[model samples]
Structures are given as C-alpha cells and as structure tokens.
Target: MSRLYLGIDGGQSSTKALIAKESGRIIGHGRAGPCNHVRTCQGRAKFFEAVSGSVNAACNQAGIDASTVTFAAVCLGFSGGPEDKEAHSRELIRSTKYKITHDAEIALSGATAGQPGIITIAGTGSMVFGRNAAKKTARAGGWGYVFGDEGGAFDLTRRALRAALQFEEGWGRPTVLRAVLLESTGARDANDLLHRFYTP
Candidate 1:
C-alpha cells in the first residue's frame, strides 16, 4: 500500500491541510476556519473542528474517505508558537508519528527551502523572523493583538478609524479616509462612529 501523509498549517485566521503520497507529491488540499483557541470549551472545539474538517476535506478532495486514508506521518504547524496546545493536537489526530510546532517555523522553512534567510509575514498580524546560516534563529513582533503586530491590517484599520474620527472632531487634518470609512460603514456622521465602535 502506498502510504499517505498529512500536513496541517493552523493559524488564528484559518487552517490549511495538504495530503501527499510517500513520494512527496501533493494529492489533495483543503482549508477551514480559524483554529486559535480563544475561550474555554468553545475555543478548543473550534480548533478541533478546524483540524478535523480540514483533514477530512483534503481526503475527500482526493476522492477518499478520511477513515480509509491511513497516514504514515502527520505534522502540524500551528500559530501561537510553542504554546499552540498539545492536548488539542492529540485529539485532532491519532497518528503515532506526528509532530507539532509554530506556524512560523514552517513558513520560514518554505520561504527559504530549509536554507538560511529572513521572512516578514504581514497579514491579519505581522511578524519578522529569521534563521542564520549557522542555524541560529530570532524573531520580532508577534506580541499579541495589542502591543505588537505594528504593521498588520487590523492595526491599520483601527488607526484609520481613529484618524477619521479625529478629523471629524477637528482634532486632526482632513483626509479622504474619513469619507471613505464613513461611506463604507454607512455612518451618518463622525460622532456616530464613536457609538458604533463602542456600542458593546
């Protein structure tokens, strides 16, 4: 029997799974929702659901049932680095030959093809990580949703919103972003943003 392998990349925003043969040829791929453990049971359940759903989807894409596909090895590169959670991993897969690590580890490996190089990831969050020729590694950013991720989309959006509000209140210079944001959100005026943004 030609064995199959599974590789998962789970992150705060989404999860991806790939199935390949022993020869390293990718046969199937799938995607699922965010797997980040956010709150108690719900968090864990979401993570597990993403993992299982991704794996099964990949299997289905390859025209096989997940139960019939025996994996020789399973590797999970997940977000949140070393604190991704081992218990959830155990519940996600039943493979003995399995390993789990931070999502950035795989990102770096793929970006450099196991060679030495630097990689800066900018998405929902932003991070800079690198590996030297001698195998030394270092990282900057990934400092949670608040203090870090300086150049991420979420941060930029919030800043734009703030800028718009400030401009409307005559505290900042006028800019087109204010109009664009208001038009997009359908806010009647700048004062309405305050209530909408903080209504919760």
Candidate 2:
C-alpha cells in the first residue's frame, strides 16, 4: 500500500492543496475558491463547499481515493481564530485522518522548516509573524480589514474610496484616482455621482 501526505493552505479567496508522496516529493496540487472560517460572517455551508471542493480536486489530481489515504495530514490557515479552526478541524477529522492547524502555521513550518525565525507575509492581506530562538511564536498583525489589517487590500480600497469622496466635496486636491473613478463611473456631476457610487 502507498501513503500520501496532503497540505492545505486555506485563504480568503482560495484553498491550495499539495499532495506529496511519503518520500516528500510533490505529486499533485489543486486549488478551489475561498475557505474562510464559516463563523466569521459567512456560514458553514459556504466554508464546507470550498474545503470539500479543494480536497476532492486534490485527491482526484493525485488519482487516489479519499478512503485510500493512509497517512494524511492537512494544514488549514483560515480567517477566523481558534474557535473556527477547531470546528473546521473536527469536520476534517470526521471525514479523514488529516491533521489540521492554522494556514499560517503551515507557512511558518515551511518557511523556517522547523527552525526559528521571523516571517512577514504581504499578499492581498498582510501579517507579521516571528518565532523566537526558543520556538515561542508571536504575531504582530492580521486583524482583517474591518478592525485591523491596515494597508491590506481591503484597507487600501477603503482609503481610496475615502479619498475619492474627499476630493469630490472640494475638501481635498484632485488626483488621478478621482478622475479615473469619475470617468469610469460616467458621473458628469455630483448629482450623477450619487447614483454611481456602489451600483456595481
């Protein structure tokens, strides 16, 4: 019998699964859309669909049956914190013998490869993580866009909207973004602009 190892990196917009042989060689990789925690504004059904799709795609790519996975492990880096993680992990365990943890932990494990170091991740979102020489770990940021995650994509988008509005009210100087936004929205004047904001 053959064994397979699975690694999952769950994100807000997508989930990536890496299937590797017992010898540590990657055999297949698969991806599906958004696997954020179900408890954080989104419900369980959406979360489950995303995860199941990713896992099934991965298994199919590896040409292995879900039941044939002998020594499977999964790492989930989802948006919500411990509570959400526990629930998702439970779901995975009920279905398979995969180990589960935050997606960041898997990234750290890969970056440091079991060593100790600091890692800064800046993608659609941003987060700073550090592991001390003694292996004590800490995270500096990653609060999501609503409360934290300053300079993140959502944060940047919010800032852009604010800037656009400020310029429109003559409270700020005109900028390229303002012109671009007005042109794109086809707003000839403020009266027209009111209707253009957020129609899409």
Candidate 3:
C-alpha cells in the first residue's frame, strides 16, 4: 500500500491544497475560496467550505475520489490564531492524522526549507517569524488590520485616505491621491468622499 500526505493553506485570499507521497513528490494540487479567519470569525462555515473544497479538488486531480483515499497525515495551515477549535473540522476530510496551525508557521518552514531563517509576510495581514540555528522559533506582529497590520494594504489605504482628507481640509501636505481617489470613486468633491467614508 502506498501512503500519501496532504498540505493545505487556507489563506485570506485563497485556499490551496497539495497531495504528495512520503518521499515529498507532489502528485496533485488544487485551489479554493478564501478561508480567512479574521474575515469569517462570526461563523466557521466558510472556513470548512474552503478546506473541503480544496481537498476534494486535490483528490480529483490525483484521479481519485476523496472518499476512497486516506492520507497518512494532513496538515492545515489556517489564516488565524488559536486553531484548537478547528479540531471539529477534521471529519470534513479523510486522514489518518491531522494537525492545524497558523499559516505563518507553514510560510516560514517553506521559506527556509527546515533551515534557520526569518520570514516577513505582508498581504491582507502582516507578521514576522524567525527560526534560529538552535531551532528556537519566535514571532511578532499579526494582530490584524484593526490593531497592528502595519504593512498590510488595508493599513496603507487607511493612511492614504486620512492624508487625502487632511489635505482637503488644508491642514496637511498635498498629494495626488486626493485627485485620483475623486476620479476613481466618482465623488464630486473631497466632502463627498468624506461623507461616503463616514457613512459607508
């Protein structure tokens, strides 16, 4: 009998899955919708959908039915912290063993290939992780856009919007962002933009 392993990344933007042999040779790959915990904290249906969808696609890509194959181990890297609650999602797929953790851990391991190195990730979220020569690991940031998310696009956009508003009020430096935002959003003036931002 041959054994297979599954690695999945349920990220903010998309979900990805890869099935491989014990020797690390990949056999199948798949993609699905967003499973970002930060965005779906109110419920877990979307999260489960993302994982199940990707896993099924990956099994199909391997020319097999998901119900017919059992992975030796399944690792799911999710886009949120406190993965303990995800244990309930295990039965959503078939695996002899299953584990779930934050996506950044998977990112670091892939970046270093089991070696010592540091990784800085910035997308819808931001974080920095590092592993030392002695294999000691440490992490910083990743508190979400509302709290820290310094380098994330959301944070950058918020800054730009604030600056644009300030310039309109004649209390900040001039920037072309104000003109561009007006053109893109079809706002009649800076006040219209401000009203839109505050109301919606």
Candidate 4:
C-alpha cells in the first residue's frame, strides 16, 4: 500500500482537501462548506462537529478513513486567525494527525514554494501577501467583510447598487448592467429593488 498525505486548504466559503503521495503528487481531493469554525459555530463543541464533518467528508471522498493517512496537514485561512481561535484549532488537531496552521500561510507556502514573491487573492475577500528573499513575510488587506476588502465581489456589489440607484434617479448614464442585474434580481419595479441584495 502506498503512503498518503492529506493537505487541506480552508477558506471562508469552502474547504479544499488534497490526498497525495509522500512525493507530493496529488491523487484525491474534496471540498466542503466554509471552515470558519468560530463564526459558523456559536461555541467550541459545535465547531468541533463541523470540523469533523469536513475531515470525514474529505476522507470519504478519497475512499479512505481519516486514521489510515500516513501524514496530514491542515491550512486554516478563515476570517479569524489562530491566535484568537486556539480552542477551534485544538479541536481540529485532536481529530487528525496533521499540522494545522493559518490558511494564508499555506497559500504563501504554495505560491512561493520556498521562493520569494507576492501573491494577491481576490475572492469573497481580498488579500495581498508577499515575502522577501530573506524570508521576511508581509501581508496587506484581508480585514474581513468590513473595514477593507474593497476590490472584492462584495465591494463590487455595493458599487452596482449605487449605480442602480443612480440610473433609477436619471442622474447617471444608462448601463447594460442594469438590465442584467434587474433580470437576475427579479425586480418587477422599484418596490422589488430590495431583493437584489439577497440574489447574489
């Protein structure tokens, strides 16, 4: 039997798991819901349950049991960092023989792969992380849903909303986005505009 190593990259909206050989060639993979244990679960025990579900789901997808893995590592990049989420981190460790660290750090490691460079991520949130050749790492943005993440989908939606209002008031030039937006949002009239926020 070949030895397998599991690697997980957790995010705010999803979790990705990769099962690979010790030589680092990926073999199996799986994904699940957001891994923000603290925010998703109201308490510690509940958070552990969610983590267990994620780990088991991944293992099941790979046709293996969690205990059978020769080695494993989990990267947790969520809204909250590990320093403030020690309890949740501990719970995850208790469930698997894996090294757990912040998700951003994992991204950095993969992006550079022992080299030095900058990596910018734009997803539900935005973050710019970089490291110098000498191993000095730095990060900017990733302040969460509020305070920052200005160029992400959420921020883009805010601008769209403003544009919609502007077009409605006849203060701005008409845009093709208005029709696409209105159709997707199912806004029958002005009264239905309130539903746009919930649509996408």
Candidate 4 displacement at residue 157 in angstroms: 1.2
TM-score of 1: 0.87
Query: Model 2: how far is 60 from its true place, Å?
Result: 1.0
Looking at candidate 4, the ten consecutive residues that score lowest on lDDT are 71-80
Model 4 vs. true fold: TM: 0.76
Candidate 4 regions off by >4 Å?
Answer: 1-4, 40-53, 67-73, 93-101, 170-174, 196-200
Residue pair clashes in candidate 3:
none
Q: Give the candidate number with the greatest lDDT.
A: 3
User: TM-score order of candidates, best first?
Assistant: 1, 3, 2, 4
Task: Extract clashing residue pairs from model 4.
Answer: 76-103, 77-103
Put down candidate 1 lDDT per residue, 31-121, tens digits, no spaces.
9998774453487788888988899889889877887556889888876664646666666666658777777878999888999998887
What TM-score would you give candidate 3 relative to the actual structure? 0.84
Cα deviation of 36 in candidate 3 (Å)?
1.8
lDDT of 2 by residue, 1-200 (tens): 55666677877767787778878888777788877656655657767777767777877888877544544545556654445565665565333454555556667889989788877766556677778778898986777666676766767766776787788888977767667766877888655765666463
Which sections of candidate 2 miss by over 4 Å?
67-71, 92-99, 182-200
Off by over 4 Å in 3: 38-42, 182-200
Clashing pairs in 2: 76-103, 77-103
Tens-place lDDT per residue, model 3, 1-200, is 56999999877778999999888889889899977673445437777788788988988898768877878998888776645535655667678787887778888888888789988888777888888999898988887777787887768878889899898889989999899889888889988987877782
lDDT of 4 by residue, 1-200 (tens): 56666666666667677777667777666666666546543534444544556667766776777654444444454444554465665545433454556666678788778688888877767788888889898988887766887787777877787787788779977876677677887787545776646554
